[model samples]
Structures are given as C-alpha cells and as structure tokens.
Target chain A: MSGCDQCALAGVLPPAPTADPGRPRLIAIVGPPNSGKSTLFNRLTGLRQKVANYPGVTVEKRLGRARLEDGHEVALVDLPGIYSLSPRSEDEQVAHDVLAGTMPDFPRPDAVLLILDSTNLGRHLMLAAPILALGLPTMIVLNMADDLRKRGGEVDAESLTKQLGAPVVLASAAQDQGLEPVWRFLTECGAAPSPVDLPALQDVPRCHAWAARLGRHAAYQPPAPPIWTRRLDSILLHALWGPVIFCLVVVVVFQSIFSWARPLMNGVQWLIAWSGAWVGSLVPNTWARSLLVDGVWTGVGSVLVFLPQILLLFLFIGILEDSGYLARAALIADRTMARVGLQGKSFIPLLSAYACAVPAVLATRTIENQRDRIATILVAPFMTCAARLPVYTLIIAAFLPERPVLGPLLGTRAAAMLGLYALGFLAAFATARVLKSSILKSERTPFVLEMPPYRRPTLASLGLRLLDRAKIFLRRAGTVILAMAVVLWIVAHLPLSAGKVPPIERSLAGTLGRTVEPVIRPLGFNWKIGVGLITSLAAREVIVGTLGTIYGMEPDAKSRGLQAALRSDLTPGGAVALLVFFAFAMQCMSTIAVVRRETGSWKWPLVQFSYMTTLAWCGAFLANRIVTALA
Target chain B: MQANVIRRRAPASLAELRKGEQGILDRLDLPEDVSRRLMELGFVPGSPVVAALSAPGGDPRVFRVDGSEIALRHDTAVRLKLRPAASAAAN
Candidate 1:
C-alpha cells in the first residue's frame, strides 16, 4: 500500500487474519508530558497488566494484554513520555534507547501510537517527527479532541493523516471515545512506511519548518488560556500570598486525606481484621495458624490498611495536576527553590515524595538538568512519605494528649496530627539543606517548565490516574514488601526456644537486635526496637506490625493501641529519640533502589545511605540527651 | 561585516568565548543539553547577560544572564563563557 494511503488506513480494521499468530503485537504509546498518553494507555489496558522491570533494568516497564473486539490479544507497553527522540535527560534517554532497541532487555515495538493533543497539534507533533523518522510502523492518536472542539477548533483528521503520512485516530481518553478504532489500528498495522526520515543532527530551522508544514496540514492552533486559569493565576500566582496559599493547599490536602479517608480506612481495617481472624479459626495447628495469621494476613493487612489514605491523597494530587495547578505551583516556587539548590521542577517530585518517594524519584526523569536531577534524588528521600505515616501517627498519638486546642474550634487529635505533619516537613527541609551542602554540593540547576493551560479536571481522568498509582504501589508491596514481611516474621518468630524468660527475649529477632544493641544504645533503642527498625525498612507501616510481633500482641493487635504500647514500653526520653531518628531517616528501601536506578550510579544511593544515617544518629542523640535532662 | 559583528554574530563556536567578559545574547544556539532547561526558565532568544559574579565563600555563584538572574557553580560556568562585544552592541 502507498505510505500516504497507509496513513488513512490507520485506526481502520484490516481483513480477517488468515493465520493463527501466537505472538503478540507490541504497541507503544508516546507523546509529550500531560498530553493524555497515560490516559489512553489506561483506557486500552485496564486491569489485565503486569509491571515488569524492563527485563533487567530498574525502569518500570508496563506490559498489558489488551483483547481486541475480535478476541485477539496484543501487548501494549506504556513508555515514559518524551518531547522528542533527541533526548536530553536520563528518562528521555531511556525512552530513546528503548525505542531504538538500544537497551539490551527492552523489546522493539511493532507499532507506535504517537498521541497528540489536537489543540496543540504542532508542538505535540514535534515529538512525532523524530519517532516517525525512526522508520517504525506508526499511527497518530489525536487525544483531547473534545477539548479542541470546546475551543472552536477542528482538526481535519483525514487530511492531516495524509499530510503526516500516518493514520490518525481522534480520541478523548476521559470520554472513552475512539478506543475501539485505536485498538484496531494498533493490531492491524505492521511494517508501515517511513513518513519523514529527517536526520538527527538537522538544526532547529529545519525542525521548525517541518513542524510548521505539519501544523498547516493539521490546521493546528493552541487554544488561548481559559478565563478561569487567568482568574486563578491572579491569586494563586500572586508573589507574596502564593507561597502562603501553597502551604494552605498542602495543609488542606493532608487534612482532607485524613478526614475523608477515615470511614474507608476503618472499613478496610475491619475487613482485613475479620478475614485474618476467620483464617486463624479455620487453621488446625498453632504454628500453621500463626504463620497464616501473622505472616501472610498481617503483612498484606498492614499494607492494605493504608489503601484509603493513599487513594485519597493521590486523588487530590491527580485533580491538581490534571487541572494544571501543579504547573503554576512550580512557577510560584521557582525562585524559592533556586535559593535552596533546587529548581522549581524539584517541587513536584518533592511534593509527590510526601505521598510516596518511589514514584517521586521516578518522576525526576522529567527534570532535564543533570545537576538538578541528582540533587532532587538526594533530597527526595528526606521528604516524609506515606510510609512514615504510621511512625508519625503513633508518635504523635503517644506524646501529645488529646487536649482541646482553640477550644471548640478544632479536635485535639486533629491538631496534634497537624503539628506532627509540620514537624515532618521541617525535618525534611533541614535534611535537604544538610545534604545539599555535603554530598550534593552542586549549584542549583536552572530550569524551564511548561505551564499547561488549566481545564476542569474530569472525574474519569482523575479516577484513572489514582487507580494507576495505587496499582503501582500495591504491586511493589506485593513482591518486595511481601518477601520482606515473611523474612521478618521468621526473624521475629523463630528457633523454638523453650522455658523462655519473656517470649520476645527468646525470639530470633531479639537475638539479632541484641547483637546490634551496642551500636544503637546511644539512641536509646533496645533490641526489640532495633528489630522493628530493620523490618520497617521494607515499608514503613510494617513498623507497627513489627512492634506488634515484638510485644507478643495478636495479629489484630488493637487491644493495646500502638500508641499506648510505645508509651508504656519506651522511656519518655527513648520515645523522643526514636521520633527524632525516624524523622531524619531513609526508612524505605524501595525509594533507595529507585534512586540508584534513576541516577544510574551507586554513588547517590551510597551518599544518601551514609548521610541520612549520620543525621538520624546525631538528631536522635541530641533529642535523647535533651529529653533526659528535662526529665 | 556589520559594525557590531561581535555581538550580533551567533556564537559560531563556544570556543571563542572567555570568562568574565559580557556580551549581548545575539543568538542563543542552545545545545540540546541546555535548551529544554532554558526554555523552562522563561529564557528566550532575546534575553540579556552580564559579567559573572564570583561566589562568596563556598556558595554557588550568581549570574545576571538571560534577563532573569540565575545561579551556577564555577564548574558549570567554565562550560559557558562570554565573547567580547563590539562597543555599539552595549545595551
């Protein structure tokens, strides 16, 4: 078929397959950031997916089985978004390397669906020129078509298809439109002809010329900024009040997550507890019962209890990002971050680090400056992530009594939680400054960021994004956290010693803790405390479970609240020391691994390890000594 | 050649530039390395520049380059120097 004609046939169905092909077609979705590439991937793949590390590399490679209308299944891989194939940063380099099959483990795609926002077709298609030049079989998915229609614009999709010499499918992922056509296009297209094979070294004028030609053929126009955006920017982007508003936004965000997720969190907690008890009742032997109840059920239950909190936090984040407030937040903070040895681009990742640093560190690939990327990686671990929530919550509940503050204006519990949240942020900032001066001693990288125009966030889009993040979190916990939990359970429950002087003291975990006691003694951490810290490195909430196991408590362990248990067992000074230790520590291994992978060096991970440990040591030492003196 | 050939000339090569000199940003041929970043910081082709400020203590040095002020370490600045501007080119 003629290459131009092939463009028209894209998104159209092919004749019935003559042979039964067992191999799956690999279709990759590519586009600029925030252009709805991820939205399209979510629509196509849904839940039938697996996130394998791109074989051996640390980058997450998502592969999903998408069954077509004809019942033929294809493997769809969602690649990291890039503005162009001429990559500047590590993430973009991963994109470029994967696309070129330069990465040893990544599979070459059979067809690429280059997603374009119909409203900004020209700028979006700048990415396409490079991909199309790769001579891969390709189709263009014109995403956000509905947004275009609202702005009094229309893409002559067919004419544009012919001009670009690739098939075009118009879709709005949020609306669930054009998905079937997209599926058909990807499955049928193979070995499509190259559209424009421009050399990589060609300068800007030629690239712009090609972009302009494509713009004319596509009838491209970027819509004017919306009225609501301009109005919001006047207040939200106000120099003085902007940071204040941003802080208020953060406070409200955390408060809402705690307030709204309470009911849901309670329900999940009830279900997991009920199921664990039910399973324990069914098992015959004591050892079997404890293994199933304490090891498997307790591990999953601990991870699952955070589900509601995680979902609510991510839900708010998704809305802010999709509506484009995040971009403005970055603009407002750009100058402030410059003083702290970070670019404004560091804010999104740092902010996301609060919910979870694993994804935040992964997201730093969006920062193009190497120094900025490295500095971001160094500081990201310092942000108190959701993993630290259990520790923070337990400590706050234990130390701060429910004394009504601003009587009748706020709940005492709520106010205490807020204070601890502020403390976490302060510790994070202080730690970031320390790291910046020492190992990450580079100058603040200058950054340029695109502030996409604001739009009303669609509920479907927000839900899809929230679900995606939760899924990623759950998958990581399922493998890494699950394995760590079982190992820790054994360490906490082993050796079958008889005539024990206190059951915990005889356990393998206690033995291991005692072995390390001398090192941790200055921080006021005993053997049991030492064990909890090690087990918690896998996921932070497990600290509560580890404490439960160490204290000889049940799987459902609410009889002795985590707070009461800590307060009663730990000396007041010891409690304060532990709080200070957790406040400055890198408690999650997943974040460290992700950082190592992203920076492509052990250098950063090692520096983060040593520096954070030392900070935790000194902070804990000071806290313990001061609290003891006061006592 | 133009009267202000030095300033108006696109940095034909970065090799011609030197430390401590000031030049108008005649044309910014942003290398792929710096382009995406410069774009993000609102530094377009027509921005201005000034002589680099030596850092105080171990602090990162500040630059009055590209309209807005920016900070960079000495190592990175060495990677970017300035060419002498013809007299009329002074803004």
Candidate 2:
C-alpha cells in the first residue's frame, strides 16, 4: 500500500462500492467511438468478457468481470460509444438508458469510467458534461496517454479532477501503461462527488465551451495534428487515383478471402474428415456410429470449413478498421451508396457481406440512422457470401462446359460465376432502393464522421478480435448446427425395417424429397435435388455435403462418380435455375437467426425470408423457362 | 433553432470555403439535433476551421477544426456559416 495516495481526494470521495459480497459493483465504461474504451475494457477484464444484446435492441452490450488489485471482484458493462446524452440511434439509446437505469435487465451503473482521448480532449471532453450531470460516481480516464506524450500534449490531472469534482487518471490501454492509477481508482475511496455546475444537456456550444475552459484551466496543451495524415489523405482521398486504388483494394480483399483462403479451408476440411473417419472406425454399424460421424461431425465440419476464411476476413476488417483506412473507403463509397439510397458507413459492412452476412449485419451498428441500418441489414444477404461459394463451384464445374466465352479472356464457367455475383449485387442494390423509397424512408441523415489519424494497428487488438469471432463461430457450430445435423440424420434414416435402415427411396428423407418434387419439378429439379434443397436450409453450403451423401445413398448415382453424377442428374435449364435460385434464396438458418437477433424481432427476418424466397422461386421458374426455350 | 438566428453578419457557408483556406465558424444553420452534433465536434461559433481536402467524389469535404479532422457532406457543411479567417483575425 506504499503507492496508495488519497491525500488530495481524502474528504472529497466516498468509500468505493463492491463492499457488498452478494451483488458485485457495476461500472459503466463510456466513451466516444475512438476513445479506446474497448481496449481498456479488454485490458481490465482480459478474457472474462461476454457479448450479448441489451434485451431487444440491435446494439450489443459487452459485460465483463474484473478483479481489483485488492482482490475485490466487480462487473464492467461497456456501453456503445456516443458523443452526447441525447439519444438519436439505438446505440445511443442503449448508452443513455443504461446510464439512467431505465434499460430493462440492467442495473444503474454504480460508477462511470469516462474515457476520452487525451490528444483530442477539446472535442472529446464535451461528453463529460451530461455524464457528470448523471451525478454518478465518475472518474475521467484520459486514455491514449502514450500518444498524448508522444505528440507533446499534456494535462494536469489534479486540476481537471478538482474542476470536475472527480478524480482523473491518465493511462494508455494500448501501451498498457499508467494502469496502476486505474486499479487504485476502482479499489480506493472514490464516490459520487458534490455536483458541479455543467451546461444543459442539449446545449452543445455551452458544453463545448465549458470543457474547453476546464482544459485551459488545467493547463492542457492540445497535440499538433500529424503531418503524415495530411500527406496520406491527399492521395488517398484524391478524386481519380483514390477511387482507382480503392477498387484495387476491394478486388484484393475479395480475391484473398476467396483464393488465399482456399488452402486453409482445405486444411480445415481434411481435419474434419480424417477425425470423423477415425472416430467412425471404432463404432459398429449402429445408429450411434452413423449419428456420430454423419450427423454431428459432418454437419459441424461443413460450417467449420468457413472458419479460416472468416478469420482471415475479420483480420482484414480489424486491420482496415483499426488503422483507419475503412473510413476512407466509406467516404469513397458514399457516392455509390447514395445512388442506392444508403450512405458511406454502410459500405464496409456491405463489402464484408460478401465474406459473410452474419458479421455484415453486426457491422451495420456503426451506421447511426436506424432506417439506414435496418435497410442495410435487409439487403446484406443479397451479397453472395462465402457460404454460397462451394455450392456455386460444385454446380458450375459439373454443369457448365469450360468453353471460352470471349476467346481466351473469359470462360463460360467463370462467366457463370461472375453472373451469379452480379445477380446478387444487383438484387441488393435494387432492394435497398425500393426499401428506402418505401418502408425504410427517412429524412436526410447528416454524414458527419470524424476522420481519425491513421496509426499502426496493434497485434493484440486484432488477435483478440479474431479470437472472439472464432469463438462465436465455434459456438454456432457446436450448438444449432450440431443439433440440426443430428436431427437431419435421424430424419433421413427413420422408419427402419427388420432393425435395419432402408434405402434412400423407402426412407423418410426420400418420401420427404418425393413429396416436394412436384412443387419444384417445373424448375427441372428431381427428388434428389429436392433433398439437397431441403437439407440445405440448415446452411446453404450444406447442399454440397448433402448432395455427396444423397448420391452415395441412391443406387445409380454412386456408379457415375460425383461430378459425372451432377452432370447426368441436372439439365442445362435446371442447372441454370438452380444457380439462379441459390443466388436469391434465404436458405441459411444462421443468417436468418442473425437477422432476427440484429433486427430485434422475427418481423424483419420473416419479411426478408418470405420476400427473398418468393423472389428466388419466381427467378428459378423464369430461368428454367428461358433456358429451356433457348436450348 | 438559434443556431440559425443571426447575431452577427456571418458571410459564407463552409461549403463555399475553398481548400487551403481557413475560416471561423459563425453559427450552424441546421436543425437542432444536427447542429448540436456538429457543435459537439468543434463546429462551435468562433472556432477556427481550415478546409483541409475533398474526398474523391468531392461531396463530403474534410476540414481541420479544433485539432481534429472531420468530414461533412455538402448538405451538412452547407449549413455551417463561417467568417473568412482573414476578416475574423483582423476584427
């Protein structure tokens, strides 16, 4: 306790909370978007954090437990970043509600960790006014202390603390420096101080002025803007080269996630198969063995195959986002997004949609406007994701010939794949336009975004983010996907005769496929393809694995080999229809589940599902007719 | 909103300020919420703003104000009335 110093704040503070053993003290971590609140939270909690939604909102709440230096445990609720107390979006509403103790299932925070960037205190400091108005025990965490000192910025923490009637500490979550004060603040005697005069909650200029005056009185020296930021922004935001370079970047990211991820995907696939076969060899010809290998292993493995790609995608997103190039990309995309009735912020999320719509939907939280966010969510699935890649590759390779479409420049197989991508992109763009002009209509949302200076991304932050994403993916695989696989295996093998599983035609799965065959026959699909379509509702890419199993079950399909099996089974028109159908169908249960969670209700996801499925069916029917006539 | 109520003779909107020029914000001529957000970002009256650069599409222009770079589209930036940096400094 030699380092403990409370001489200046002795009488001004109350004893810290968490003295009660039953209910741990809850401290709200609040800050602007770029304040390093998350970094601080990650540091304080380490791996103790769990992210869940705040009851029924689209924004997620991150709750983590941390232990103080004196061995007292406390819970930290990290709130979404907001500039002020006045709520404009769901993110702000969550923050405001949590602070006011009005949010359902959330306790009024015992204390507030007000994090602000020390280098940009003039602008970041305005958030202090309304927060202080909450009259809660608060400590101003001046984060990015290293950046502050490096940039020649300085502040007198004692003077600022006295001015605000709260204790202040300077720390850097990135460098992991000056965190000793944080541990002391939480564990030591710090309580709700006497209320100090602050500007009205809605009075922006007054708040700004008050914060500025306090900074000056505290001897705060603002850091000079970096010279390189301007130099970089010149070419990065240039009219011609900027857009060209942005295109190249988009192409590179797209290619890397698709092509560079191939070997890793193959590795994951091989591991799953080898383990499944090895485990299966130990079990006899019982249902348990079939269930173990075919149901759980194959089902989870299909989803897990995309893990490498997802991690790679998140790695790129984290780097681009943390290093601040995503903002520039968003600005460059604003004009094109405007054409589709969205804005710049929707660009990165939509680009990420091509990698996977699940993260893309989560990314929409960055857009401040509710209408725009919902609109983005609705259209995100129309961007063909990595889940659809295997289905596309299998079909295109088997059904289409490799004849050149434009001499040697383009092949028919490649052209078909590009067409599918373009089809999905057009559907997304058109749907967004329709949605904004109708249900999601709103007045103009001001696109006022702060351009943070580009900095090198930390390995810790990116690695931790990828770890979180991987956990979420694995959790999905272990739960819903694993269960679905088990159920599917039972359904396909049910109504056994003489205590033995029947053939694919006599089994329940065959009857199930046959029953739906008539409905899809007009689109040129048979019972085999119908089975693939039905099972793929678990996830789109499951169709590839299911088709492999389906043919393995039927007698004639096993002889022609797999690729030849598809070539013999599907007609030219049927193959094109299938491609068109997959392009528009909302077949992935995970995407639907994510949509439901993000939109806060079944209403939006149901509407999206019904509309997309209808479009897909109609599209498939039309493609079948047009192709059959051309042939 | 009083952000639009002219207390002083503010000359030009921020949109009209060319790149490489500086100006002092006179007031925000926007709705209450919008102006409030801008002011919180250091668009407060009497703060110096320099037109830093234009985006590739040339709609959302970036500006340096209060030691931070912020981007605002034409519709939002047009609402920010400013006094020429030369005139404000001379005054």
Candidate 3:
C-alpha cells in the first residue's frame, strides 16, 4: 500500500449503516463487570486458538477456530468487555470500533454473541437492541445460569428466543454448560428476523407492543437467594457494617502475606542457599562459583523469596474479583474515586501495580477508555512494586529502629514493614494527584460500571493465573535482569590493579558514573553509588545486587550481602541517602518498555522516566544534605 | 394499584421493568442526593428509561436513558417512578 493509503487504513473509521440490512445472525454478549465474558470466551474457543494482540495494538484480541458439528470452520474473536457501544475508554473503543468497523483495520464479525446474565436479563437486553439495529446476525447468551440454580431463578430460554426474535441459550461458562447449543445456533442459522415482539428503537411505549407480541418472555421469575448468600451479603454490603467488614477482610489478606506464607518463603530461601552451597563446594575458585553463588543466588534468589506472598496476594484478589465483592468494594470507594477524577475501575490497576506493573498495565485492557488507561499507566509506577520490597526491608531495618508500640503489645518488626509500605502508598497517592492535574490532563471518564453477581472462585483458574505471573517474573529474570546484571558486573569487576588503578574507576561503569557524578552528587551519592544507579537500568532490584558486588559485599565477598556491608562500609547518613534514592528512582528499563508499548508512543515513557529520575535525584540529595547537617 | 396502572402491577421501580421494557418515567421517590445524581446521568423524572441488562445477581439493573447506558442498584431502581405503555399494560 502507498504511504497515504496505509495512513488512511490505519485510521479506519467505524461504518454507520443508514438503513437496516435484513437481520443478520449476530450474537452479542452484554453484561456487568465480572459477568464472565472471558470465561465464556475461553469456553467458546477452548484452547482452539491463541490470544494475540491486534496487529499494532497492545489490546489483546482472542482468536479461535470453531468447527460446526456439521463441520464448517468459523473464525471467532472475543471482544473486550464493554458497558455499551458508546466508547468512553480505550478498551470500549476497541470493542465499539471493531463492531462498528470505525477503524479500517478491525473487521466486523459476521455474527455477534450478546451475552446476558440470566438473573439480570431485563437490564442486559438494552445493549442487545442497539446491536440488533446494526442489522447483523445476533443471539443472546444468558450467562451465569448456575447462579440462578443456587438463587431459585429460572429463565425460559425457548420462550425468550421467541420473544427476542433470536435464540437465547442459558449457559454457565464457569461450569461449562449450555455452551454447545449457543455455538451450534451461531454457526448454523444467523439471528432470527427482527420481530415486533421486543421493544422498538424509540423512547416511548414500544415495550408494550413488543411485550404483547412476545407473551410470557417477561413473565419469568428470578430464584430467591440462598440463605448463606443472603446472610453474607447483608453484612458484606450493609450500610454501616459493610465498610468495617471490608476493612477487616483487607487486613486479614495483608496479614496472610507475613504469616501464612512464612513456611513457603522459608523453604524457597533454604533451597536457594543449599543449591548455592552445593555449587560453591563443587567449583572452588572458578567463575562458575561466583556466577552461581554471588550472581544468581543472591540476585535472583532474593526475588524468589517473596513468591509465596505474591501468589497469596493474587489468590485473594482473584477470589475477591470472582465473588463479585470487588464491585461492591468499588461501589463503596466510588464516591471517593469520583472526587479524584478517577473511576472505580482505576482501583484495579492501581492495586495490581503494587505487586508489579507489567500485568497491571495489561489489565488496563479491561478499562474501556483510552484516556483513563493512559492516566492509570502514568500513575502505576508510583505504587511500590514487589521488586522494591528487599530495598525497603533493608532500609527500614537499618534506619527505623524497632520500637515498642501499643504499650508493648505489637511486634516492632511487623510495624516497621507496614509503615514502609504505607509511606510508598502515600507517595503514590500524592503523585497521582499531581500527574492527574498536570502532565496527564485527559478528561476523566464517568464511572458507569456493572456489578456482576457473586460466585465461588475456581481454584484451577486461580492457580493458573498465579502460575502465569510466576512465569513472567522468571522470564524477566532470565532475560532482561540476568543479562543486565552480568553486563553490569563485568563492567564493575574487570582488570583489577594492585593499588595502580581502582577496578571500577578504570572500567566502563566507573567512567559513566563519573560523567554523571557531578549531577548526582547533590543527591548525596558518590561516583560508586552513581554507577550503581546506572547499572540498575534493567530493574529496580538490580541496583541493590549491583551495589553489593561493586562494594565487595557479594555472596563471595566474605561478608553478608549489601545491606550488612553498607552499615559497616558507609556512615549512617550515607545508608539513609541510598534508601531515599531507591524510593524515588525509575530504574526499571522493562517497566519503561511496557509503558511505551501501552501508550503506543515514546513520548509518555520518556516523560515518565524523566520526571521520576529527577524526583529521585532531588529526594536523595535533600535527604542526604539534611542528614549530614543534623549529624 | 390504580385503574390506570400501566403494565403488570404498574412497575413500582425501574427494576420491575423487564429488559426491552420502554416507558415514560412518571416520578422519582429517590432521596435528593440520588435524584440529583440520576438527573446528571440523564435519568430525570420524565426522561424515558429502557431497562437494558441485569447483572449476574440482578441488583444493579442497567438502563439506557437519553443516549447513555448506566447501571443502578436494584433497590435504588425501585424508587424510580415509571408508567408502562398502554398496550403492554393491556397484556
């Protein structure tokens, strides 16, 4: 294609039909958040196809090959969850744009599957009619059928089909039921003709005419809630008790991170140390011993220490999301979020960023608005990630001496960890406000979200999600972080001289650090510290490992790693200065790459990096200067 | 409740209206804060509301008002005054 033609193609606009074509078979799935579009997508696709990104976009589109029972192959694409066809967020736009073919690149599906909740069919069909107006083949999937069983509700699918001018298949994607019937209908015949059964497109009594033609479709009744659920929800969403209950639940979740995961964390640490010792005994003076013990063991092993905690965190979050309590939590926070020009959905990504930003940025795919996604990305880096844990733990241990609290009832170590995490969060909230008003001045999309019903979380699925996260971390360690650490180690440890020249001073790292030392000196860091910051370009955790090796505190250095070495090696003020430096630093090159990919441009990533680096330098400098003066 | 009660039992709230149920809103009994917010969302007392989709559990009912679609808590939905069409009322 010519450049101009390519440009036009890239900006393809959605097609709006002026007249209705004979109703094509379009099945559209419409429901509230957590209503299981993704689960349904998985059922329909069933490991048949891969989830891939759109040609040039970070938004994931699931494509699968579906074979009809009669044996016709059909290509299926699962659109992102959307409240309506009217686009407010980037995610919603992708869905709307694809359906409308507003974008030249996105092809409109021949059939649309309108998924509805069996318990909430009344509200779900509002989006259905609009899709019907598109004059495409359509059917409605009444998802979450299992919920109705527990709640004492039943939908008359056959009667609803006659009333809707299309077939209604009651399926529970979570439990794998009624899926084939829906798929068979989609592949076989298209949507039924637009009947006079349902309401028309107008604002007035079209419902009356529609209902009259379609008898009994509206007469079905919802099952009553199970006693257990009723009792749970009473307190879960209670006006006065709900907030207290929710807070208690959150506290329990965090406490599990420190308490419940201790055994597993200890096991991981033991394994790392044992393996390191075994290798050290084998390779005596060889570089292999250093690589296995000091490099791999101390660097990557430290990260693995918290895997149990991370998994537990994901487990709790996944369950909360599956159970529909997340929506209630959002509803509770909605008023507060609205005040900040953010919506309830923003909380999901912000909270996820605490564990790490990679998946959290990807999770923004759920937020239908583009402006909102971009704003969320800019603020996500401020949330203290798991990688920062080791750094924070070391600093808090050294500077904030444990003290008795609550009249000696509380453990001081636990309190210190909590305080450090709190400080990171406070910084994040302040940064979010500043960035929301200044650099990222996008209009805040209104928070209009559907709160789906509660359901038991499937352990199989939750385990799979946790495994996926672990795999991602491992991949980063092996490729980005591992390579960066080795390269940094080589630069900082090469060609030692007997009092002739310093190892780092004559090496690449030292030269670069010296170049930047003048600029960074005001931040209370020497040339060696400046070099550590530069080498940490791969990830935040790399800074500590790099400093450990550079300061002769590597596992092989006859001293425990960096934190212990730092206490003896530097003045207390210098140690504090280093802690402050890591607090504000944007040292993760991988995070920067993901931000660029998500934003679809280099501008935002550069802005994020520059602002964060500048802040890190200033914060470190001020802390260092004040500490020295006080001493 | 009255002779002119539109549709089945004169849907006392928007939640009572089934999907595809279209009606001219009669009145709102919502508290002042909620009613103001509803109006901001284009669900003014007289504006037509077409019940769209009910969520999985069905408490927050999605409705289309003006050109926008929004979800409302089912309890809050019950306070929205609505008049069903004469024909559907006849059904």
lDDT of 1 by residue, A300-358 (tens): 67767767777776777677777877766655655567667676668777776776677
DockQ of each: 0.06, 0.59, 0.10
Q: lDDT per model, in order?
A: 0.66, 0.83, 0.63
Q: After superposition, how far is residue A614 of candidate 1 from its true place, in Å?
A: 2.7
Comparing 1 with 3 on DockQ, the higher-scoring candidate is 3
- Residues A447-543 of candidate 2 have per-residue lDDT tens digits of 8777888888998889888988888778877887788888788878888978888776677878889999999999989998888888888888777
By TM-score rank, best first, the candidates go 2, 1, 3
TM-score of predicted model 3? 0.73
| lDDT score for residue A57 of model 2 | 72
* TM score of chain A per candidate: 0.80, 0.92, 0.78
Pairs in steric clash, model 1: A7-A167, A448-B40, A448-B41, A449-B40
Best by TM-score: 2
- For model 2, the stretches where C-alpha displacement exceeds 4 angstroms are A1-20, A552-571, B1-11, B83-91
Candidate 2 Cα RMSD after full superposition onto the native fold (Å): 5.5
lDDT of 3 by residue, B1-91 (tens): 4655553565666878887787777766865544543543455555677886443345455576644346676556777777655533443
lDDT of 3 by residue, A584-613 (tens): 667777678667656767788898888777
Interface RMSD of 2: 1.5
Best by DockQ: 2
Model 1, position A43: C-alpha lDDT score: 81
List the lowest-lDDT window of 10 residues for candidate 2 chain A: A1-10
**Chain B TM-score in candidate 3, rounded to 2 decimals?**
0.77
Ranking by DockQ: 2, 3, 1
The per-candidate TM-score of the B chain, in the order shown, comes to: 0.44, 0.79, 0.77
